[model samples]
Target chain A: MRMRFDKELEMLNGEIEKMGNLITTAIETSVKALVNQDMTLVRIVNALEMEIDEMEKTIEQHCMTLLVQQQPVASDLRLIEAALKLITDMERIGDNAEDIAEITKFFGNKTFINKLVHIPQMAEATISMVKRSVTAFVTKDKELALQVCYDDDIVDNLFLTVKNYLIDLIRQDVNNGEQAIDLLMIAKYFERIGDHAQNIAEWVIFAVTGEHMNTDNIGKTK
Target chain B: MRMRFDKELEMLNGEIEKMGNLITTAIETSVKALVNQDMTLVRIVNALEMEIDEMEKTIEQHCMTLLVQQQPVASDLRLIEAALKLITDMERIGDNAEDIAEITKFFGNKTFINKLVHIPQMAEATISMVKRSVTAFVTKDKELALQVCYDDDIVDNLFLTVKNYLIDLIRQDVNNGEQAIDLLMIAKYFERIGDHAQNIAEWVIFAVTGEHMNTDNIGKTK
Candidate 1:
């Protein structure tokens, strides 16, 4: 029975890792789609989002079943709880990616609104945070999880840079206002995705140390 | 043992309902603050947000303990799972409200943005959805849950109205761009709050009927 429980636990870990990979791919694809104005990549991100949803529900059911069948205590319980929370964050990341894709579709064929430098950089940092945070969970690496939390600052700073740049663009020419607002919203979405990734990392920390990272002001924007 | 489980389930129900009320108040106050330009109410909304966060963590711990100690199965398992998911949505509602308050603070003492009609209406609809969705859960009323899902359409429609109005205002004069975008964002946040409430209602339906509401495209903007 103990062996069977251990095997099932291993399976749960595998499922979450798979979901994490799908989410990171979706985020990366969404940003690439926006920067390049590529509809095909946007479609792919949407498709990836649907798959992520299915994976989220599947992992959720699997975790519940484990809780019921095994009645896991101590670290086992924490692992299952963390898995449940992590998937929700993963699903939100997918949703935010889809949001970015939707906005990209809205901007279809529109002229470039300044070179998309900081936005892409922000997306890369957020995607890395997503990947490493999940790896921290799968490997029980607390340091990696903490590092993911720290990287959120980079995403946040880039968001401010994007905001200020867009504001300047809007001020210079009122015609740029619409696209500037759209770009600002896109940056905000990426920032939110970063927060969700940080939330996953916090849960990873919780799973490892039995203490939730201080997330009191987590979603607040500067 | 069965009676004890029933009692604990009732306690869980009560806890979630309480959280739901606090969330709705926060939503309402944030909107009122925005409409009236009242800093006092904004502060109140922020304070309520902190309490809502505390309640979320406490109830989450309680649910985890219930799961670990009782090992509830079948319908009871569904109830606990639904409650767990509900609080996450509820906590998000609080966060979104706090976000609205933050934006309201940003817009302090600003002049009128087209009389603030539909945004308030959207807030009202969202607060009702939040309240009724939780009531549906507490009563195990699938119809009410379905109704909450239907009501989301009203909020979505109001969002479009708000968006169009802001667009027209921005087009009329370039100087209105900043406040117009801010108002649009506030409307977007309320739309998001409504989505979160509808999500809670969907979980209610799931608890009662063992099927998640078809939320495949939920949170997608038109």
Candidate 2:
């Protein structure tokens, strides 16, 4: 019975892995659409959102069934529950991508002042973090999870850079403020997506070690 | 045994209620800080964030213990699971309030093109949604839970109004861009807090009915 339960638990992980892959794909399409100004890709990402959400609900249901049928305990139970929580974060990461696509719709034919410099780099960094956060879950590597937290500092610095840069742009010309402000929001949403990815890495640590890992790193013994 | 278990669940709910109350207070303070531009309240909200993080961890630990000890089935298990998920959304909502406070710090000692009329109203709507979302769980009131979903729509419409209003502000003068962007982000954060609050309300509905509530009406149905 326990072996059967293990397969089921493993299947739960597989489903999450698949969901993570779709989210990554969604992010890719969203960025492509935004960068290339392709409304087609944005529309696809929008339509695919329902699929991603359906996958999320399916994974949550599977996790619940495991808890009920297997009565998971110790690390196993935590892992399943962590998957439940992590998937929500992962799903919202997808939502942020959709938000980006929606923002692209608002921009229409306008050119961003920076010519898409920071946003794409931010997306690249964010997708890297998303990949490693989930990889940390599959491997249960605390160091990898910790790296995810540290890498988030880079994202924060990026957010500050983009915000200050936009502020400077608007201050210099004042008339260019319209495009700059939209780009600023686009950057802000990307930064927030990175933060959610960090949240998933934290959940991976919680699952493996039975501890809550706050990004603030307070109240810990060094 | 069941009586003892019920008592344990009550303790868990009581603990969450305290955290809920803290968050409500935080929202109240953050908005005051925002409107009054009170640095002291901003710092207070920032400092209290650690306590909320600690409370989240404490609740997670307690929930795990109950899950392991009680081996709760069906409704019992679902209730604890819902609490676990609830704490997460609650914690993120707390973080959103803190983000708003942080935005207040960024505003410094300046007034802008657009007035700050809608933000306090948005904050109040989110806080009420959160308070009632948790109450829906405690009282198992599907009616109230569903009502929270409608309330989420109010915030969404408010977001649309704010977004369009800010967009027009950008188009009109464009000089107000930086300040407009800041206000827009602050508004966006409050809108997201509303989303998370709506998420809690959905969880409450799931816990009560053992089925996911429809989120189709999220920004529209109300």
Candidate 3:
């Protein structure tokens, strides 16, 4: 019975890992589409978001089933709960990615806005954070979870840089207002993605160490 | 044993209802602060957000305990799972309110760029939606849940009206850009709060009927 329970737990972990991959792909493709103005990529990101949402529901139902049938105790219970929380964040990441793609569609063939510097960097940093946080959860690595939490600072800083740069762009010419707003919104979405990633890391920590960290500042635009 | 389990379930429901009241208060105060530029109210909203977050963790722990200790089956399991999902949406409502209050702080005594019309309406609509959704969960009323889901369209429509109005404001005066963007962000937050409320209503439906509704379009701006 114990062996069977362990196998079920492993399967749950594998499922979450798969969902994490979908989230990363959404993040990567959304930003790539923005930079290259690739409509096809935008459609792919949108479709991936639907898949991610479906996966979230599937994994949630699976987690609920495990809890009902096995009545997991202690560490096992925490693992299921943590997965439950992590998937919510992962789904939000997918939503953020789709939102970015939506904003990209608004650009409407406008030429590149200020070379798209910090925005892509923010996306890259955020995607890595999502990847590492999921890995930490699967491995139960407290250290990696902590690293993901700390690494949130990088994404936060990048967001500030993007905000200031966009502000300057608008100041230089108010004619840049519409595109600048769109770009800022996109940057904010990436920052939110970073925040959801930090949330996943914190849940990972809670699952492993049973210590709840204050995450109030995780995604705040400080 | 069954009587004890039922009693415990009632207690859990009461705790969630308490949490729901806190969420409603947060929503009310945050919008009041935004319109009135009340810094004190802003502080109140922030503190309430913290309390809401704590309640989420407490309720989550309590639910997990109930599940593990009692090993509830079938309907009971579904109820607890739905509560788990509801609290998350509730907590996000708190966060969105806090975010609105945060944007209020940045406004810092600035006069309104335009008359506040749809925003306050959106707030009222969303607050009612939040209240009715929670009540629906407590009563297991599918009609109320469906009502809340339908009401989300009202909030979504108001958001679009606010967006277009703000865009026109920015277009008329370049000086209006910053405040316009801030207002837009606040409107977006309210829109998101409505989305969270719709999510709660959907969970209520799921809990009562075991039927999942497609909610991706709930709070989306058309």
Candidate 4:
């Protein structure tokens, strides 16, 4: 027989899923703000973060309430804990998105020699990780959650590429140094978002399999 | 009547307190490595992180065991859940310390002239927050935990000052742009650590008081 609190647990999951979607939107708007150099969208992402922060608080309280009232066992309990843990990652990702947007506003009509490649690639991969990780939560699929861990490697590689690109650009021409460094930091913010997404995926897998992940067990997924 | 799982919970707290000590050591070693340019110390911090990570896993499992075995109610159960959440924050603080050390290694005898008052000040405030927050946890003192929220403002002010300083430093000297920018990123990392500390304190408060802290009450801590 199902417990009465299952509906509240379901409600908690729905709220977390909504937070994930908002985070994805924030990342897209933020990265687009940078890649497309849209100051207007940058400001919008900035303003939108307060609402996300408020949502985080609300969802957190809900999770706490469920934990206290439901006294969930096994997977249900893990799901509540995972949702609680995942919110900080999502909130921090929203913050990194805002940081990237802020850095983008610094370049005023400055033309770069090349198109932004790795950054958008990084953003796309991050979005994929976020989407799939949350899906892993919704479906409780350990396999897909484990896959997101491997996906983080791609994000890490992109970070190295972006880092090297900025370093080479700065070394070649010292005059464009400021913008190049800012671009490097922007790359870092995106990479951090990927890290947070990996963290979420790890919690998803943990919720299902009772395992924790790090670089040591990169491909340890079954 | 003495509860059997209370012993398990005590062991869990012991592990958490041990991890807290490890973080204190990590913070010291990571900073020593940063200020003294000791690569060996940094490597030690990096290596010890695996142990901390494993400790988190083991403690989490222990929490799960207690929850499943005892089916604890209210405050006792809150303690276990609090331990579970505290471990994540503790581990992430370790990660942040490692990041600071890792970034410090990127510099090679390159001189930085900034007074850098804010980074260390921020670290101090954060350390205070972490200690006080955990003290609140151990003592179940809601007021002290609330004080940590107020202390977060000091760290935020330091971050803002550092940001303004970096902007002025970059605008004043084109040559100092790169190093100053790197310093800003480092400052950002420290500011984030402070944020995490504040987060831990908020958890401590919530676990005790059953009230989600109001940001409106954040500044007026008595």
Candidate 5:
């Protein structure tokens, strides 16, 4: 029975890793679509999002079945519980990526108000955070998970830079107002993606040590 | 053993309801702060958010204890699982409300911006949705839960109205650009609160009917 439970746990990890990959692809494709102004890439992001959503349902059912049949105990129970919470954050990362794509659609081939510098940087930081958070979960590497939490500062700093840059653009020329606002929203979406990644990393800590990180300070900084 | 499980389940329900009430207050106080330009209300919202966060940790511990001690089966198991999911959504509702209050702080005693009409309306609809969603979860009322899902449309339409109003304001006077973007972000936060409420109602349905709602269509509309 122990062997069977271990095998099932391995399968669960694989499924979660696959979901993480899909989320990474979605974030990357969405940002690429934005920088390139490519509608085709936008369609790809939407499709990836739908696939990610379906994977969430599948993984959830798997966890529920394992709980009912295996009746995991102690650390095993914590692992399954953390998986449930982690999937929700992963799913939101996909949603935020889709939101970015939707805003990119609105840009409609117009020249960006400024070269897309900070926004892409924010995306890179979030995507790396997402990948590392998932890896930490699969490997149960608490140090890597903590590292993911630390990486959030990079994304947050980029967000402030983007916000200030947009504010300056709006102040310099009223004509830049609409696009500046759109870009700000996109940057905000990336920042949210970072937050979700941080949440996932925190959950990993909980699963490993049975102590949830203090997330009360999450939005307080903003 | 069955009787003990039932008693613990009742406690779980009560804690969830309390968390729900905290979320409602946060939402109401945040909106009031925005409309009244009252920093005092913003402070209240912030305090309420921290309390709500503490409540989440406490309730989560309770759920973990119940699951480990009783090993509930069938419907009881479903109820506990739903509780776990519900609190996450409830916590996010509090976070979004606090976000709105934070933006209100940015307004900083500025004079009226077009009388603040639809934003207050959005707040009202979202508060109702949050309240009804929690009530449905505690009472196991599928009809009321479904009604909460339907009410999301009201919030969505109000968001579009708020968006257009802000766009027009920015068009008429470039001076309105910064405030308009800030106001737009506030409206978006309310919309997110509505989304979280809808997610809670859907989970309530999942607890009652063994079938998860198709959330695939969620961000597709936007």
Candidate 6:
């Protein structure tokens, strides 16, 4: 019975990792679509988002079944509970990527208002945070999860830089107003992605240590 | 044993309702601060958010304990699981409200931004949605929960109206760029609050019917 439970736990972890990979790919493809104005990649992001949503439901069912069938205790229970919460955050990351793609559709073929510097950097930061948070969860690396939490600062700073730059662009010419607002929204989405990643990492900590860190300010944006 | 489980479930339901009330008040206060430029109200929103966060942790602990201590089956398990998920949406509604209040701090006694018509309307719609969603969860009213889902369209339409108005404001005067962006962010936050409320309502539906409904696109903003 113990061996069977362990096997099911491993399967659950594998499914979660698969979901994480889908989310990472979605974020990457969406950002690539935004920077290149690639509608094809945008379509891919949308498909990936649907897949992520399905995976969330599937994994949620798996967790529920495990809880009902097997009397998991202590760390096992923590892992299952954390998986439930983590999938919600993962699904949101996918949605955020899809939202970026949605906004990118409005960009058309026009040249960007400025060089695509900080937005791509912000994407990279969030992607790294997402990837590492999931890795920390699967490996139960509490230190790596802690690192993911601190790395949020990089994404937050990049978001601030992007915001101030777009604000300046809007101030420079009223013509830049619409595109600038769009860019600001995109940056905000990436910042939110970073927050979700941090939430996943914090959940990892909770799963491993039974302590939920300072999550009160997880999604609170500056 | 069954009686004990039901009693615990009732306690959990009461706590969730309390959390919902905090979220509702936060939304109302945040919007009031935005419309009135009331910094005192913003401070109040912040305090309410902290309280909401504490209640989330407390409720979460309650849910986890109930899961471990009781052998809930069928609808009982569904209700517990749904409660676990509903608190997340409630917490996010609180965060979004606080975020709206955060932006309101920058408004700083500015004069009428074109009479603030649709924004207050959006706030009203979302507050109603939040209230009804929570009541739906507590009372297990699937019809009311479904109504909350349909009401999201009202908030979404109001958001578009507010977005278009702010864009026009920015186009008309470059000076309106900063405040217009801030106002747009506030509207987006309310829109997000509506999304979270819809999520809670959907979870209530799931608790009642075991069907997740059309949540595949819950947070997918257009």
TM-score of each: 0.93, 0.89, 0.93, 0.78, 0.92, 0.93
Query: Residue B209 of model 4: what lDDT?
Result: 61
> Model 1 over residues B113-211: C-alpha lDDT tens digits?
578889999998999999999999999999988888888888888987887677677667767777887787888889888889888988988898898
* Fnat by candidate, in order: 0.34, 0.25, 0.25, 0.09, 0.19, 0.50
lDDT tens digits, residues B182-204, model 4?
Answer: 67677767777767777777777
Interface RMSD of each: 2.1, 3.7, 2.2, 5.3, 2.7, 1.8
User: Pick by DockQ: which candidate is best?
Assistant: 6
- For DockQ, candidate 2 versus 4, the one ahead is 2
Per-residue C-alpha lDDT of model 5 across residues B1-222, encoded as one tens digit per residue = 888877887888899989999999999999989999999999999999999989998997787677666667777777878888889999999999999998889888998668999999999999999999999999999999888888888898898889878877877787787788888889999999999999999989889987779543544455
Off by over 4 Å in 1: A216-222, B112-114, B216-222
Judge candidate 1 at residue A3 and give its lDDT: 99
lDDT of 6 by residue, A1-222 (tens): 999999998999899999999999999999999999999999999999999999999998898788777868889999999998999999999999999999998897889989899999999999999999999999999999988888888888887788778778877888888889889899999999998999999999999999979753444455
lDDT of 6 by residue, B46-103 (tens): 9999899899989987887776667577899899999989899899998899999888
RMSD versus native structure for model 4: 4.7
Error of 1 at B152 (Å): 2.1
Candidate 5 has which clashing residue pairs, if any? none
Candidate 2 deviant stretches above 4 angstroms: A109-114, A168-178, A217-222, B110-115, B164-175, B216-222
Q: Across residues A57-143, which tens digit of lDDT does each residue of candidate 3 receive?
A: 999988887877788888888899999888999998999999999988877578965898899899999999999999999999988
Tens-place lDDT digits, model 2, residues B161-215: 8877876786676566667777888888889888888888888888888887767
Measured against the true chain A, the candidates' chain A TM-scores are: 0.96, 0.94, 0.96, 0.93, 0.97, 0.96
For candidate 1 chain B, the 10 contiguous residues with the lowest summed lDDT are B213-222
Candidate 6, which segments miss by more than 4 Å at Cα?
Answer: A215-222, B110-114, B215-222
If both were scored by lDDT, which would come out higher, candidate 1 or candidate 5? Answer: 5
List the candidates ranked by TM-score, beginning with the highest: 6, 3, 1, 5, 2, 4
Summing lDDT over every window of 10 consecutive residues in candidate 3 chain A, give the lowest-scoring window.
A213-222
Per residue, candidate 1 scores C-alpha lDDT tens digits across A1-222 of 999999998899899999999999999999999999999999999899999989999999999888877888888889999999889889989999999999999999999769899899989989888999999999989899888887788898898789778767766776777788778889989998888988898888888899977653544455
